[model samples]
Target: MPAPVRTAAQWAQFGRDHVSHGLGRMQDLVVVKGEGLDIYTSDGQKLLDFTAGIGVTNLGHCHPAVTAAVQNQVGSLVHMQCSIMFHAPYLQLIERLLPVMPHPSLDQFFFWNSGSEAIEAALKLARKATGRPNVVVFQGAYHGRTYGSGALTRSKPIYTQSTGPLMPGVYTTAYPYWHSLGVPPSTSEEEIVRLAKHQLDMLFRQQVATKDVAAIFIEPVQGEGGYVPCPAPFMNHLRELCDKHGVLLVIDEVQTGFFRTGSYFSVNHIKGFRPDIMIYAKGIANGFPLSGIVSNKEIMATLDVGSLGGTYAGNAVACAAGVAVQDVFASEDIGGNVNARAEQLYNALYALRDSPKTAPLVAQVRGQGLMAAIEFRMPNDPLTHEGLDKGTHIPSNIGKRVQEFCLSKGLVVLTTSCFDTIRFIPALVVSEEQMDKAMKIFTEAVQNVANEG
Candidate 1:
């Protein structure tokens, strides 16, 4: 067969015609392969990866150990229907992860292929256990885009624009980003808890009836909703509220699990916050497509043998990668390294805020662990206060400019739902040297694009 000769733009246009309009595609870089936290485009540009494939690659791209593990499993068995039977890798992974998890009561896990599927299972289990219908989510939440999880998502009209008439009995309340959501002032910690309680209380008035509500879904450190961490008191109180109302607390750790936040799960960050059910993925398999919903012995026992499984639910190859991921994380002090890198990155980006390059458009810097964001805002002339708090399309456009500049100059970053912010989900294994290289490039990109954006 002869090679198909066509320009990249032509190929992209072809995709545009064949694919649904809902799919977002851009002709930015033609990537070939990846290594660690760097990607090589078709044209031979090696770029530092801060997005980590949008937080999917916490161990880094094509990590040697993970790749080797996958290769070995592939030679043995890549696909096996756990619904029909079980495989070594699948059982092996659960045995390994059980001890590391926060809850001692957790006894069973149902493996799924993606974060959305994991969340879907969690929701189902919550309803099955409680025999309830209503589920509570928060404003600015971004769970996966499937029907149930998507229904739980409470951000912008765009995500839910075309897909409508979603699942009912899904309630929502604000999660505090005190400065952004027009909250008058940075509330005291007590006030934050008060506000959350008040909002949930108000929701019981109409959005969702307390008795019928099955679960309250939460992210310990929010992933897509601008990396906001729910304060400890707020989380603890929510636990109390769930206990009072017979609501299952479902922690969505799709983005916060697997040492991304210096713990196996971010829910551990709170003093006593533990979920009746939890979804885990992203970093668990170290870039493999393995996600799961875990629950207490009682809740998990409700499922019939055949109720929760799929053809590729616990893929041996993906599980093999997961097993190796945990091993490397444990033996190599990857968690410690993640903490050190977070500190290093926090210091670097914080210091760079005052740098001559980033002063104009930089509004706020916030996030946890390897998940961080640099929010770009329109230069509010504090002199006039024209739009001191009013959000404009300017920040969105500036973000695009910065993203392009980063790509052009050998760096990769991700934009967020806030539109004005670019998130950095660097790999847990990112070295100090790699960190310096990426930050230097970022500083340069900011300097180059600042005047224009």
Candidate 2:
């Protein structure tokens, strides 16, 4: 098919008419250009990007290093089947990535194209390594949408509605969300962690047998379920449980990896937790499609040759970009910046959460590093549903309203966690000035929503 030459409006209409609506469509703006965390629409409006293309561009859009790397590699070698031959960029990336692994034993890697594919690959590795038939996942986790991934995702019903019978032997367990567990806002972190840890034991006895499980998948900070950070004590307990059961502790850092969580990985916040397998994507290449998993040699050895690679698994261009990303991180204090900005963001969000007008609507303000969220709830509403019955918070699209309002103010944001929570996942390269500007707009959006309500 040839490119269509049409006006911006015409192109937009054509997309609405011809494009498959299955993909998530949050806004209608047609972006034409991007630079350093700002995107330009066809109308020549500049929007400060807070979503960072849904956490893909961690170094900001079109960082000079990444652009140069891609341009340089495209002219040399863009595609090389990993199964057929090896490449410098791929090996170089592995070399750079090895030093950053949380544990020294996590030395093995298998590249893939997307987070979903990496997750699918990890699932296969777990099952093969343990020779177990069952996999365990937490409730309200969003691993991916592929059929195999869908079986593990329990964030929302729409993801798996009419998509089952999902893959067999996949079990769901409750995660620690004190606000959603009917606990008062004053509940201490220790108590929440205790209750959450206790649920795992109940799940094992009442639900799936721990002996049959191959892996227990979880996110240090829940992404789509809301940017809820898992408490350290709870994660510590999970580590103990996995150790006792010999289940692989697979941490899905697809959204939280690459310094998004202040640390190199969110799991790093916990003192002694070590994952058996770590899967990463999103910011791995600062926008390029690259994802992979790291495991020790022994577990990785379980897969026979020709068992785990794809034709385009380690594409040269993506690996080159990945290599450049690591270089950028080495030179830039991105992890430091994320921590500093996260503190500022949390202060501002807490102000909003505590203010008179917004307090009643905000159920909680939670985050770690740059990954943050403001969860909204309408306590006065008389409506009762499954979420209410199950003691889970049901969003009322307040986050979506805030998102649209932010867009109107030349800022871009995303809604997550049941459409009730506003997630802030800006690029790690975002400056303090940019953060203040975005927060100003966000504050007004919350105020406007409160007034309208």
Q: Backbone clashes per model, in order?
A: 0, 0
* Model 1 lDDT tens row, 121-195: 998889888999889898789887888889988766677768788888887887866543445322565776677
lDDT of 1 at 306: 71
**236-336: candidate 2 lDDT, tens digit per residue:** 88888889989999999999999999988888888656899999999999889999999999999999899989878979999999999999888889999
Query: Between which residue pairs do clashes occur in model 1?
Result: none
TM for candidate 1 is 0.92
Q: How far out, in Å, is residue 247 in model 2?
A: 0.8
Residue 287, model 1: Cα distance from true site in angstroms: 2.2
Error of 1 at 358 (Å): 4.2
For model 2, the superposed segments whose C-alpha errors exceed 4 Å read: 1-4, 379-396
Spell out the clash pairs found in candidate 2.
Answer: none
Query: By summed lDDT, which 10 consecutive residues of candidate 1 come out lowest?
Result: 379-388
Q: What are the runs in model 1 whose C-alpha is more than 4 Å off?
A: 2-14, 179-181, 184-189, 352-360, 378-396
